[model samples]
Target: MSSSDIFLGETIGTAILILLGGGVCAAVTLKASKARNAGWLAITFGWGFAVLTAVYTSAPLSGAHLNPAVTLALAIKDNGIEWSDVPTYFGGQLLGAMIGAALVWIAYYGQFHAHLTDKEIVGGPGAQATKVKAVEAQEKGAGPVLGIFSTGPEIRVAWQNVATEVIGTIVLVLAVLTQGLNAAGDGLGILGGLVTALVVVGIGLSLGGPTGYAINPARDLGPRIVHALLPLPNKGGSDWGYAWVPVIGPLLGAAIAAGIYNVAFV
Candidate 1:
């Protein structure tokens, strides 16, 4: 694929991935939505479907390396792609993730407002509008709706969070690395998409509890950046402190996976 195709394919595919994935979170979390509290099963399956659609749509153009870790692992595996193309893939994935997140905001604008201010209802009688809530202020990371944009840990153990991200990413990147039925660049056909999607669902079901399974750096960071920038009310912190966990952990896991693939699968 040409640089332009790589750029555009990853951009569009990652965008779609985040749009549907994040859209599910928004639908489930935000008040007054039809899918409110649809539960974790819905989220895991929604993300799987999102992966299927995005990968299938963009595979012909760029092999649908929608996740930065996937791109890195594929590049490391030397899947007939040049090292020079890695940066292009990363750029497209990050840009696409941000765009997808913004689109989710637009799609759920009203729902976001209602959810954020639901408790404060109208900001009228005895509202604490002047001062931020103590819980919001004291808690340094993750706000009311931050989950819609990025992952956060349930228990907040640094080592545990990093380990979870690393393990999940290892499984994800390894799947792509070991998948030999299709040409690496093809991600060929819907079968490839189906396998990847099912793997993602499996990972989410088995490994998502700790850190929400942010196995992809662009998927987590780009949307988290959007969360920080958007004008959503009472949106709380963007959790910049924890952001490095997702990014570094996934990259590290990808590297380990690449090393393993070279040693065992090659």
Candidate 2:
């Protein structure tokens, strides 16, 4: 395929991915009014399926990178991809993410506003305890804290999140490279799709608890950028403090995976 076709495919494929993947997040979190809180399993499987779809659609033309970290890893491994194309791929991924995020925002505009009012109060420990009491009182007769999403140390530890992303990406790239080598006959045609689903499912099951398994740099950064740019009521979309980890962690993981795969497996 020509570079132009590859670029277009990557752009469109990534956009669809973010739209479906990120859209699911918005539906579950921001669209609580719609009773659309997709639980952990939903998120995990949704992303797995999204990856499968994206790879199947774009692998023929663009290698289905859809992530800057993946592109960087491939370039480092092959050394044949022109340096000039690196920027193009990254640009397409980011642009696609932004576009996909905008669509998500538009789709969930009403839900965003509805969930904004369900804020958790914060203060000193005593104040927090009191706030919890107040919330409980207000929510009397409602079953225990159902469907309320809260960020806590166990779930949001920075180091843990970064580590999980790194490991997840490493496993993802290793799987891709391995499948690329051994695929046979019609199986070769489906290898990309299968690997895409498997990697995401593995990450979701193994590493998702810490960082939500944002193993793709473009996947995290693009949606976050859109979250900031889009006017969603009370949506703190751009959590800048944690953003760099997803980008840097995945790149580091991919590089390490490539090196290890080459030295040990290849």
Candidate 3:
């Protein structure tokens, strides 16, 4: 694929991914939304559909490597795309993710206001327990709405958080690599995209609890940056300190998956 095609495809695809994916979080978390309290199952399936939609739409152009880890894995595995195109893919994905996140905020502007500005909604009567338990969460650094944009751990142990992200990403990248290495370079065929979407849902259900299953770096960091930047009243901190786990862990996992594919599957 040409550089323009890769950039445009990745940009559009990842934006859609986060829009719908983050939309689900907003719908479930933000008050005044019809789907509020719809819970975790809804989130997993929402993201699955997000992947499926983004992939099918963008596959012809960029092979739908919407996630940076997928791009990194394909690069390391020497998938059909030129290694030089990796930066283009990364740039597109990050920009797209940020766009998507901002869109989510726009789409849910009222809900965000209702949730963020209201102390009752922000912390509620159960605020103390939540702050005590999830010390690295909304009360400390990551705001309550931060989860709508990025991932965070239930437990704040550094190694454990990193390990959870790594393991989840390993599952995700391994599945993508196993779906038949391809010419578009990311190996996501039409069927591959559907299967990968389901695989994402599975990873969420099985492994999302510990660290929220941020198997993609762009998916996490770009949105987190937006969360930090957007002018939301009483939105709290963006949890910059815990940000590296999602980015580094997924990259490491992708690299490891690439090594496995190269050493054993290739």
Candidate 4:
């Protein structure tokens, strides 16, 4: 594809991916939304549909590599996607992610406020445990809104978090590389996109407990940046400390997947 087509397709595709994906988080988490407390099954399926929509819409133009890690993996393979096009893919995905995150904020402005302001009784009947937990969290300076924008580990073990991401991304990129291996394997055919979407849902449902299955660096980083920049009321710290795990782990996972594919499958 031409550079302009690559850029425009990736930009638009990643934006839609994030809009629907992140929009589901807002729907389930933010207070007062109709889908509030909808649970993880809803999120997994929502993200699956988001991937289905974005890939089908952009495959003709850019092959719908909406994540930078996916772009990097495809480049490492002998796929026709040129190394020179890497920056275009990255640029489009990052910009698209930011736009999608901003749209989610705009769409759920009220719900965000309600969520951030929500607090249990600090010194009431359940005060002892609640107050201690709140104080500990205050020292960490992390906020609840961060989950809506990006992933965080349930347990803060670094290697474990990184391992979770790496394993999940291996499943994802491997699927992308090997799926629909007929005449249409050059890009996602209609069936390929649907199957890819289901793979994403499977990843989320199985591996999302630890770090929310970020599999895509742009999907995590762009929205985290927006979470930091947006003028939301009482939005908490963006947790810059733990950000590197998601970015590095997925890139590593993609690279490993590419190496394996080149050795065994190619």
| Candidate number achieving the greatest lDDT relative to the actual structure | 3
Better of 1 and 2 by lDDT: 1
Worst 10 residues of 4 by lDDT: 118-127
Q: Please report how far candidate 4 places residue 155 from its true position, in Å.
A: 0.4
Error of 1 at 59 (Å): 0.7
Residues 1-266 of candidate 1: C-alpha lDDT, one tens digit per residue: 78999899999999999999999999988777999889999999999999999998888888888888887777777554578999999999999999999999999999998878876532344666623543543376677788999998878788888988999999988887776225545343557678889999999999998889989999999999999999988788898999999999999999999889888988
Q: After superposing candidate 4 on the true structure, give the runs of residues whose Cα lies further than 4 Å from its correct spot.
A: 121-135, 180-186
TM-scores for the candidates: 0.92, 0.80, 0.93, 0.92
Q: Write the per-residue lDDT of candidate 3 for residues 109-226, one digit (tens) a residue.
A: 9999988766455555657665454454555587778999998888889998888888888888888888734544454887788889999999999999988899999999999999
Each prediction's whole-model lDDT (CA): 0.86, 0.66, 0.88, 0.85
RMSD of 1: 3.0
Candidate 3, residue 136: Cα displacement in angstroms equals 7.3
Model 3 TM-score relative to the real fold:
0.93
What is the C-alpha lDDT profile of model 4 across 72-108, one tens digit per residue?
8888987646789899999999999999999999999
Clashes of 4: 0
User: Candidate 2 has which clashing residue pairs, if any?
Assistant: none
On lDDT, the stronger of 1 and 3 is 3
**Model 3, which residues run further than 4 Å from truth?**
78-80, 123-139, 180-185
lDDT, candidate 1, at 228: 98
Instruction: Show pairs that collide, candidate 1.
Output: none
